[model samples]
Target: MWLTGRSIALIAAAAVSLALAALVGIPALLYVTGLCAGLVAVAVVLAVLARPRLVLTRTVTPAIVEPDEPVEVVLDVGVVSGVPVVAGHWRDRLPSTVLGTATGTVPVTGEPRARVEYVVTGRRRGSHELGPFSVSVGDAFGLVQRSLVAGGRDRFIVLPRRHSLDVRVGPAGATDGATRLHPTSGLGQDDVIARPYLPGDALKRWHWKATAHHGEPMVRQEESELRPTVLVVLDADPRVHDHAGFEWSVSAAASVVAHYGGRGFDVDLATGAQQVSLESGHGLQDALVVLALAEPDSSPLIIPARERTTFVMTGSLDSTSAARLLQAVPSRDTIAFVARGTSEDAHGALAAAGWHVVVRDSNEDLEAAWAAATGVPA
Candidate 1:
């Protein structure tokens, strides 16, 4: 409960009226003072009654989206008891870091229900709460105001957007021991199970016997082929990078994983301590989300496995660490994305050590960096 500017002015007028009536002995001034006081009392009571009657409900379309995409938020406000509500103001509470403060006016105009809609962009990748809508109502006379917090919150996730890669890739590295144990069976082998041919099935792998028996082309469901693994190591040391640099490194790592995974190359994602190999029963989206929310890795980078191709994204790396990284993968198979601040000698040593090196300055685009490092157009 609070007094509006109009309420303050009215009270001041009443005080003046009383003063004039007492000093000049004017009886009409007393009547004027009484009227003003009565109106003020009525305004205050109306404001109190109007506040509790407001209802707010928040809804969002496409609650899950990629970062930097726009999202629509709708706020439905209605009055209980179908009563006429005066024009009011409203503001939706959101995290400043996520979305800036959003505020506007609520015009009832004799309607029992009203809707307020706004747009906000998901600027980062993560799960975030949208709002607890707040509304402020004042009396028609604007003599008193009441503020109420009314709506529940909504949760949404801004997933990391995957980048497209147009470059050609080489054969995958060796399969893990687990894959070796479950090698794909051949068509004529006893373990062979024939299934109806699906699109993209190789014609050469079709079983002629099964096709003749079933009158439809059937393909052997050979166990999935084991592809060479591409290990991706992301260095998230906070001491080495600012927030922007860390995000870039994350996006770079995610892009590499996605590029390799899409190309049928077994992809493995690793941070300072966490390692997720998609070939080993890990979900792709889950891996991307982990990368999206990855914090600076306090522990140093330790390669989890040997692979045909290794992509390393880091803020900074010393010569010793660079040398160790080169030895982690096959010769000329490591590609390094080094954020600015790494020494020239480190870059030179990594390159001389047969690692493809890309040195990126602040805010460098990932596609451009990749093109520069691999000598391929994005």
Candidate 2:
């Protein structure tokens, strides 16, 4: 490419002044002007021919960072032949989303070799590509410029930040089971009943009813049954809240799934993008890995109603749709964990449709909501 218009204009003016001085027969002026013009031309040629011999290597302190966190990017520039580098400019190419309206140039100067460090804050969650950085080298006269593009690029994955909650879920009789069984001792309507004390029963099991009628102490016994199954549905709506809020919700959902699975209940997770079912083994770690890679999307409910406890986590609910599904599967218990800013009417609608509703304002509210829905002591 040819020199820029400004460079050409300056060179032309210097040449014209030198020629006029020579024609006017001013010996001293002509000699000085010619010398100056020749110097400028030689300087411009050197600057234009000055090939950038520097190599650039970038190192990001952390290849992955959480949303809203800061990541440091360091660039090392070294001259191949030990040429003393005076002053140069470094441009670390960043994504448009990351750079926004900011300028790209990063000033660099050193004694032949140096490293430049910069910090970039992650404002969103996703994969961001860094680099194709370039280094520009020029002479002191600023007449010519030469640049070299870096060879490789770096990639960074910005994950979402999650919050924790203290909560548990299980069936009535069995601590960890696939079927919901009525508690033999609790206030509930079920076919199971308590029996009188036996000879091998402990003193704590004594019942006074048989003692008063038959003049003997009786103990209470419970009926045995299978465990209840639970399914967790996560609504990953990107437009519902900010990136941080969405990440927190994902973390809360993963915790809840882990909590229920630990208690021995058959746990299944349903999200807008994927579905995971842990029918007979512990799979919390695998489930979390899936959750980590899941991206937010806006979609309607995709979980089908079954004969099990279904926990729905969403910012909002469609009452009529939820009610219809609940009506179809009356044997299964339905719970709606409404996220912050969800309409109150949605909860009311779920309640009217014979489904339990728990509204959460933050991660703390998640614990309270889970306890209320599962009747588990927090």
Candidate 3:
């Protein structure tokens, strides 16, 4: 539905020739106008008749990736029944949420099928739709051009990055009761079961009720252990941090989730917007996706992080935001990973709330910051 440069030049030439024929009384000028006009008309007719039916399929390799991770995209192109498409240019629409070069020269051989490819990296930690791919086609004389659009859309996702907070953490204070209990049989001497007593068994192991009911002495045998639970909370207030700082907080929370979950701690993740109970350290993907799609919220950080061990990951805080953060928690063991630019009031408030506050820059080494938070001074 647009004009090409060549068509514009031809139209101009035809108009000039007709004008010259009228003023200069030259029959040759009229012939030139007729030729130019006739050629333009034929080009238009060909453009209208020569329509193409196109099918495009696209794929993103390594369906799961983190921000700035390069992903290769392959577009399979096929032409069904239509006018013979001449060799032209093809370009895929890459949205603002992604970064890549999506244009290439498309050589239309006699074959009906072809392939185009490009690489795109997701700009942020979320899912974004890719395209409604289109290509340009034109007549043999290159006087008229038309566009062919492929149907449908494709979705791509970018996950939050996880850092190895290389610190051996001490007991994360957690509650005793749990819905999903992992059996710790033979690991410790707690939660013992009564069994038939044997000779040489200690008197302390004897169960009086079993002895009376079974007509034989029954002794206690120990079995089963319970895994501790930890709650990882992310602060989503936009006023507390700039863009980079907020992103860093997200990555830090992801690291904490992975670290404890792998070591057998039941983990739960929370943002001001949503909370996901990752009981028994299962549903790790569910936690990550939440972080990926999370946005800064105006809601106060007053969600209950009642677990014995609670982690608060957030950016630099002023006095006001620090007060807001203090509202949700004063858990038995509280840890806060905060930005380096934090005000003194913020630090004092967290300490008053009994949190072991750790401060560092968004770009600082994650391991170093974690070590400082959990280990003895180096």
Candidate 4:
């Protein structure tokens, strides 16, 4: 409990009155001092008892959003048991970058429960937590106040906004219409032919009508091709990129993933030590969430030597690191988006190694940078 200015002033006046009563032997002054003391005691007791038996729960609508979108946070405050407080204060804890503060009052009447709604805008892309809510209650006279923690925290992720690119970066690995031949593997819409059944084949693959026609156990033959795969490598080492540089890299990487993944290309997202190959449907959203929360790591880039087309987005790159990348991806068929502040030698090394390199300044437009990198008209 904390004393308000009024409470402090009353206590001081009481002490002065008591001192005067002792000096002048005035009974009225003693009564005035006693009255002030009694009021303070009552206020203290009320403040102590005014701790509201409150249950608080916080929920955020659309927990995952892109930057600049507003998220509504609703705090439900219900009184379990206690005298209805005349007034109470509440404040929500939020990230410093998120706009707006949650501050309001609990009214006297209406329902035993109240909902406080506040909209918070995400200023940047990343994961954020919205808090342990704070509640304060005081006596009717507002002389003493007591505060308590009411609610647990909730997590929200602000994903990077996907930018539109006029120039199409086609799926990697193979042409759009190309198909790969496979032994009648899994059942799918692609099965086109039936041949004599092979040993150890599952009964499910046996074509019953085709077997009777061929006078033998015939199995279905299906032809399916692996989808073109695109690898997105993000360099999140804080030593190279400051906050702005890192954000740009993240945005660029997200754009690349969204672009090809939308075209039915298999997307592989890698940052720091984490790597995941995305499936169809909700897979891209799941990958973006991980990318939004990715932080800097001290490890160097570890690009696999696979033949899939690779895209590297980094704040800075040294020659040694570039050489290591060349060693892993010897085809040098990689596309590199090197952000500002990287050494010229690093760019030179990657370029000399046959990689298509895009050098971007701090303020360059993403589409224009990409156009210049891929020799496409924006």
Candidate 5:
């Protein structure tokens, strides 16, 4: 129930008389009540007739951004004929990942059109929805309020940043006849020869004829090849800490893949999300598009094992998982490019599994780690 000015005035007058009965005396209080009630009634009637109907709309620019990038949002409001709307409150709905303050009430000016603008910075990568902004308008007297919800929701896609690395990992295992090559082309093969049975030599590659002649087991020591297949595996676990670091790792991995892909090597990408295999002619643009569209995943790796597989992970790995990954392709060379600050247990497990582990602190270290893993000159 809403009160008119006359009703409010009459109530005020009665309250004043009760107060006067304890102060100026009941007679004076009663005399003043009648006069005040008549005036207040007029004010209430005027207030009720002046409230206005309002409509609000909102728009956001470039509804997508990279992590840490900013976006602009604008709100427009219109008033329909009714009681004049003096002031109102508006609340903007934003994604939880977005950081900062967002809610305001602005006084309406002589003109009904009002524009409210603000900037939002995204702290993580993923798709976010914003909207269904709300508004509540009221008359100057604060007698009546009409609230409304307006505007459709908008979506924003936050992409990971581009990262670069220094390491290049080579394909796993050695092939007969041809030298053991680095996964990427252009780098020349090593020219080392095998000597009489070394403690570390694998028995499978042993030359029995040489062992018979020399009276000792001897394994062929051929130079590493120059045309190695490079596979980059990305861990998309959202539970991992340091979102920025993970994104950077992805960028660095992409850079390496692009570099090797351009050099005519067969490059394959494995992520928690999906697998992408590109033959020699695919360019960086295709790779970038994939990176931009990639989102964090908690799924297990489903890609089949190959001769050379490089696992690029941004978080720590457990022993069982590491063992399973290694078992998937026993003959293939495995390189685990992990974040620099992983736990000792993870490191120990990977090392025990015979994976060439390269610890990187930033995306910048990726290329260097790869080069080191594959024994390629930087």
Candidate 6:
């Protein structure tokens, strides 16, 4: 509830009339005071009773998105139980992570309904809430004002900015053609001919020999090789990365996942404290979110084993961590994308440790940078 300027002026006028009646001993002035007071009381009641009841429905297009991506929000306003207000304003509450214009004049139409639209850009990562819409309306005489609030909070998941990358993941020539991949095709001797039966198994393709041995029906299915695994490590030590640098590292890590997990290869995302397997498929979405929310930690970097392919995103490598990495990985086996600001001594340390060290790609010109490094077999 709020008192408008008009309401304040009316109260002052009523007080003046009452004072004049007492000063001049005029009973007629009492009628003026009573009428002024009555008008103010009536306006207050009208403002409350006549204010429109706004029911809000909020819709956000592409509820989940990468950082800096535009997301459209449409707000539908429905009037249910009060006098329809022609003069009113609506404003939406938004968090700092999202940027948009959230206030506008309420529309007037033949029906008691309206729509409001605003495009917001996600400035940061994580799940952000956008709402608790409010509308303000005043009485016909404009003596007083009131507001009505309605609507539920909508959550928008913002992922780290994903960049274009053309480089292939996993070690080159690590597996023979037969072991690396075997596509399922029309029935033939080369194709896999025996597997446990599934609900949709075709009767003609059943393998009788395996079924007789196992005492159950077996079905012929395509033989696909296990995907090669890659480990993408993030050097997010608090001593190295500040806010901007940390974001760049996170985006780089996400691009690595997109390279491996996006293409049906197995990937593991690792920080100092945790590691998550990001298997290709719906797992890609979960992997991106993990990178988006990644922060600088105090834990020491974990050196992955020599068997799996390893890619590291880091600002600089000190001698101590470089020595530890050399002990775990074979010569020239690990690849390190060091930031532009990395010192010469750090580069020497990594090279001495047998890492295929490359210049960390800049956020700008992402594809070109990635291709330049991973274009050659590692």
Q: Which numbered prediction scores highest in TM-score against the true structure?
A: 4
Residue-wise C-alpha lDDT for candidate 6, range 1-378, written one tens digit per residue = 787888888888889989999999998988988887898898777666764676889999988897788899998887664653444788899998788889998777667678888999887887878889998777667776777788688978899776766434322322221222223335555556455442223456577898888665564545442234567788777665657667777888888788667656567777776777865434888778777767788776555444555677776556665564455443244577766666677779877655667675345455554554555332
The whole-model lDDT of each prediction reads 0.68, 0.58, 0.74, 0.70, 0.60, 0.68
Model 4: weakest 10-residue lDDT segment is 173-182
lDDT of 3 by residue, 2-46 (tens): 568988888899999999989988979988898888988987777
lDDT of 5 by residue, 1-378 (tens): 255454566677667776886686567666566666544554456555655555776676777566688787887877664546555677778878887555888655677788877778776666667777777755555544556566677766666554443322343342331222333333234654343432123457577777677665455644343344567676676655366666766776666676567655557777764777777637545554566666677676666644554556555555555554555433344566666666677778777766677776654555566666656676
lDDT digits (tens) for residues 287-309 of candidate 4: 88888888878776565556556
Instruction: Estimate candidate 4's alpha-carbon lDDT, on a 0 to 1 scale.
Output: 0.70
The TM-score measured for candidate 5 stands at 0.56
Name the candidate that leads on lDDT: 3
Residue-wise C-alpha lDDT for candidate 1, range 94-186, written one tens digit per residue? 875476547899865566778888888766887777778878766667777767776588977777666775443322231222221224434
Q: List the residue pairs that clash in candidate 6.
A: none
Name the regions of candidate 4 deviating beyond 4 angstroms.
9-30, 49-54, 79-87, 170-223, 300-305, 328-332, 340-345
* RMSD to true structure for each model, in Å: 7.3, 10.5, 9.6, 9.6, 11.6, 10.0
Evaluate model 3: give its lDDT. 0.74
**Per-residue lDDT of 283 in model 4:** 86
Q: Is 1 or 3 the stronger prediction by lDDT?
A: 3
